[model samples]
Target: MAEAMPQTLLHEALQKHRAGDLVGAAPLYQQVLKLSPRHPDALHLLGFLLHQAGQSAEGLKLVNAAVATAPLHTDFRGNQARILLHLGREAEADKAFRAALIATPANPDALRDLAITRRDSGQVVAAAKLHARLLCLTPADPATLLAHSGNLIDLGRHDAASALLRKCLLLAPALIEAANSFAFLQITIRDLDLARDWFRRTLAAQPLYAAPHSGLAEVCFFENDLEACLRHSERALELTPDDPQIHVRHGFRLLAAGHVREGWQEFEWRLKRADRIRREGLPPRWQGEPLAGKRILVCAEEGVGDELLYASMIPDLIAAGASVVIECAPRLLSVFRRSFPGCAVHAYKREGDRFRPVHRYDWLPKDPPVDYAIDAGSLPSILRPDVASYAHQRPYLTADAERVAQMRDRLAALPPGPKLGFCWRSKEVAPFRNLYYTGLSDWRSLLTDPAIQVVSMQYGRGWREEIAAAQKAFGARLHVLEGVDMTDDFEDILALGVAVDAIVCPSTTLVWVGAGLGRPVMEFGVEPHFELMGTGKHPGFPTVRVFTRSLAQSWEAVTGAITDAVRTL
Candidate 1:
C-alpha cells in the first residue's frame, strides 16, 4: 500500500501533464517524488514541467539526477538530451543522445534528437545516416523525410533530395514545407514554370507563408518582370521583415530596375549572408563620404567578370584624391596593374585548400593603414547612382600595345575576310545561366557566312572539338589562332578584341572584356543585367549593343536576327 500510494500520485501527475495542466501536475509530481525520492519517472516529469515553466537550470539538475539514478533507461537519457538541446548545451546533449541510442538503438525519439543535434553541430553525414535510420523505423513520417531530404541537398544529391520531397508531398499533400522545398529545388534547376506552379501551390496551402512569395519574386526577377518582382518581394518583406536573403534579392531587383538609391540600400544586406567575407582586422566599410587624403581599399566581392566590370570606377576613385588599392582575382592582377598604374594591385589569396579556387581578401597589407574598405560592386551605387551618372562612359581598360600588334598581325595573315570573334558559351552552367547561352548548332546560321572569317574566342577546355565540329558540319572556315591561349591571357583577349573587326556572342565575360576595350560587340541574352538596365545600350561602353530575346521567341529567331545583322556588317 505504501508503494501503491506513490504510484497512484505518479499516475495522476502524468494524467494532468498529458492534459496540459502543468500547474495541477507539478505538485502531484512533487508528492510522488517526496514519497519515492529516486523515482526516474517522477523526477523526469517534474523536470520537464519545470523546464516548460521557464525554470531550466533547476529542471536540468533534476533531469540529470534522474539519468544518474537510472543510467541505462532510454526515456531518462533521451529526455536529458532533449532538455540539454533546448538549453543550447549541444555537446552535452550529443553525449546524452549517444548514450540513449546505446541503451536502445532504434529508439525513435532518441534517434531524432541525435540526428538534429548532429546536423546543428555540422556533422551532416552522420546526421543524414541517423535520419535514414529513423525513416526506416517510421517510413511515413513527413517531418523526418523532409529533414533527410535537406541533408541530401547539403550533400549535393539534389535528385535524391527531390525524389524524397515528392514522396513527402504524396504522403501528405497538405505539407507546406515539402511543397516549398520542391519549389525551391525547381528554382535552383531553372525550371521557372514548374517553380512558379509549386510556389503558387504552396501559397494556396498556406496563404500567409512568406517564403513562397520570396520564391515568386526571384522567379519574376529572372523572367525580367521587375514590377512584379518588386511587388512580390515587398509583400514577402511585409510578411517577414527580418529575412536577410529576401532583402538582398529585393536589392538586386531594384538595382536591375534602375532604382539605384533604394536598391543600394537593400543591397547592403549582402553583408548579412553567411558566405560574405568578414575582414577580421580591417577598418569599417566606406559609406560614400569625401576622402581628401584617405587610402581606400576596393575589395573584389563576387566573380572575376564583376571585378573587371567594376574596375571601370577606379580612375574616378583616384581622381577623387583617395589613393586606391585593388584586391582582385589572381588572373586580373596583371590586367588591372597595367590598366591602373596609379593604384596598387594585389591578387586576392585563394582561401581554402580546395582544387577550385575560392578567392577572398586575405592579402590586405597591414603596414599601409587603410582608412576604409568598400566592395567593388558597391561603387556603382555611390559613383553612378542614376542613368545620367553613367555619362562618364569611355573605354577605361586598354590592351597591351605589343599584344595588340601581335594579334593584329596574326589576324591580318588569315584568309582575306572580316575577322569576327565569337564566344557561344559561358563558364557558369547553373540551370538559369544555361538560358543565357546558345548551342553551337544554333550558331550555324552565323557561321555559314562565307564573307566572314570566324575567330574562335571561346575559352575553356573541350572547345577545339566544338570548333572543328562546327567547321565540318557547316562546311565553313572558323579559324582558331594557333599560339594565343585565350583562357589564361586576359591581355591577349583584350588585344584580340582590338584585332577583331567585331565580336558576336551571348552575355559572357568576353562581352564585357570586348566592350571594355572599345570593340564593337553584339550581345544577345534573355535577361537584362544591371549594366544594361535603363537603356538597351551598355552604360559603360557605347561600342556594345544588346539584343534581348523576347519571352515568346525561340533561339532560332534570335540567331536569325543575329545572322541578318552579321550579313549587314
Candidate 2:
C-alpha cells in the first residue's frame, strides 16, 4: 500500500474530498499516510474526513498534530479551529482562530471562523465588529450578512437588523436565511400578518427550507389556532425531527390551549437546548402520576411578569405535600423572595451544591419522578385569583421613595393637577407593526388639548423624535419627564406609575401593572392583542379602558376616542 503512492495521490485525494467522495479516497489517503506518518497534508485531510465520519476526537488529535507540524499553514489552523468549534471547545478554538488569522489576515473563511468563535464565547460585540469588517471585503457574502444581522438582533437593534435583511432580500429574494430573519423580526415587532406573508414567500422560494415551517407553527400558536400550530409543527418535525425548540414550541402551545396532560409530557424537550438545564440547576424530572411528599424544585421560565403570574401555584403544590424551591431571574430575586416568603428562592444561573430532591421536577423524565411540576402559566388556573378578594390590598409594587419624591417635585414645578402619564410607543420599532400595536399618534391627540398635562412615561428610542415633533405642534401641554433615567426594571416602572394621576399606555405589560394597581389605565392600540378586545373590554384586566382601531386599522379613530373619553373625565 505504501509503494502504490504517487505524488498525484494527495492531489487525487484532495479532489475526491472536494467532490464529497470520502469513501473513494479513504484507501488512497491511508496509503499516503502509511508511507509518511508525519505528512501534514495527509494528516489535515484525513482529520477533516474523520470529523465528517463522526470520529471527532481522533479527528481533533490528527488536526492538532497537523497544525503543530505546520504552524503557519492557514488551512491546517482553520480546520483545527473548526473542529474545536464543532466540539464546543471555546478557548482552544479561539487560540486556533487567532493563529489562522495571523497566517492569513485577509482570509474571509478565517474571519468568519473568528466571528463565530467570538459569538460562541459570548463576545458578541467583538464578533459583530469582525463580521462588519468581513462584509466590507465581501459585500455580497450571505454568511457575513447573516452573522451581522444576528449580532444586531442580540444587541436589540431589531430595526437595523431588519433593514439589513430587507436589503439582502432585495439583492437575492430567494435567500431563505434572509427571509427567516425578516420573518423573525416581524414576529418580534408583532407583525404576525406580515410575518405570515414573509414565511409564505420564503417557503415559495425554497420548499425544502424546513425552518420557516417552525415560524408558521409559532404564528398559529399566537393566533390561538392550536390545530394549525400542531399541523405546522408536525410538518417542521418531519423535516427536522431533532429540533428541541420545535418540540418545546408545540408542547407549550398544546399546554396553553388546555391539553395540559399531554402538553407537559411533550414539553420536556426544552432540556435538549443545551447539554443541561443551566438556568434552573435542577435535574430533569419525568412525567407520570404526581408523587406524594416528594421534594420538588419548580423551575421558573421566561420573563419577570411570567414568574409573578405563576407564583400563585406554590400553595397548591405545598398542599399536595411537595416542598418547593423557586428558581428565577436575579432582578426578580428580591420580588419573588418577598412574594413567596414561605418557600425557598434563588437566582436561576447561580451554581451551587445541588438541592437534594426526593424527586427532581426540571426535566422530562420518562417515568415522571416527582408528583407534579408545572410552568408558571399553570398557576393561574390552579389558583383562580378573585380580584375582589385582593382588591383592597392595592400596590403589588413599591415606588422608590426618593425617586417618587423627586418625580413629585418635578411634576409640582409644572402646571398642576390631573397629570396623565403617556407611554404611547412600545419598545418594538418595525414601522408598520409598531404603528399597529402602539397608538403613539393616537395619544398625541390628547397631548394637544392643553387641559391635561402630558407626562412622558414613554421610554426607549424614537421618543425624542416624536417629542421634538410634538413640541413643534403642541408646545406647552407636553410635560416630558426630563433627566429621569428609567430601565426595564419594575422598580423604575412602578416609580413612574406612582408619580402619575393615571397611566395611558398602548397595550404593553405596563397596562397590566397599572390595572393591577387599580389605577385608571387607558389601553389604546390599533389592533387586537392576544384576543384582548374583539370590540371592547380587555380579557386580562377588566379595569383597563379599551380603545382599539375603529375601521381598517385607523389610529386616528382610536386616538379620537381616547381624547373624547379624557374630555368626559
Candidate with top TM-score is 1
Residue 289 Cα positional deviation in candidate 1, in Å, after optimal superposition = 1.7
Query: Residue by residue across 334-417, what tens digits does model 1's lDDT show?
Result: 888888888899987655322123454445667767889888978877887777777786777888899999998998888877
**Against the hidden true structure, what lDDT does model 2 obtain?**
0.68
lDDT of each: 0.82, 0.68
How high a TM-score does candidate 2 get? Answer: 0.72
Residue-wise C-alpha lDDT for candidate 2, range 349-404, written one tens digit per residue = 43322211122324433343433455555443333333222223333434467766
Estimate candidate 1's alpha-carbon lDDT, on a 0 to 1 scale.
Answer: 0.82
- Where is the poorest 10-residue window by lDDT in model 2? 352-361
User: Which parts of model 1 are misplaced by more than 4 Å?
Assistant: 1-141, 144-161, 184-194, 219-224, 352-363, 366-368, 461-477
Per-prediction TM-score to the true structure, in the order listed: 0.77, 0.72
TM-score: model 1 vs. ground truth: 0.77
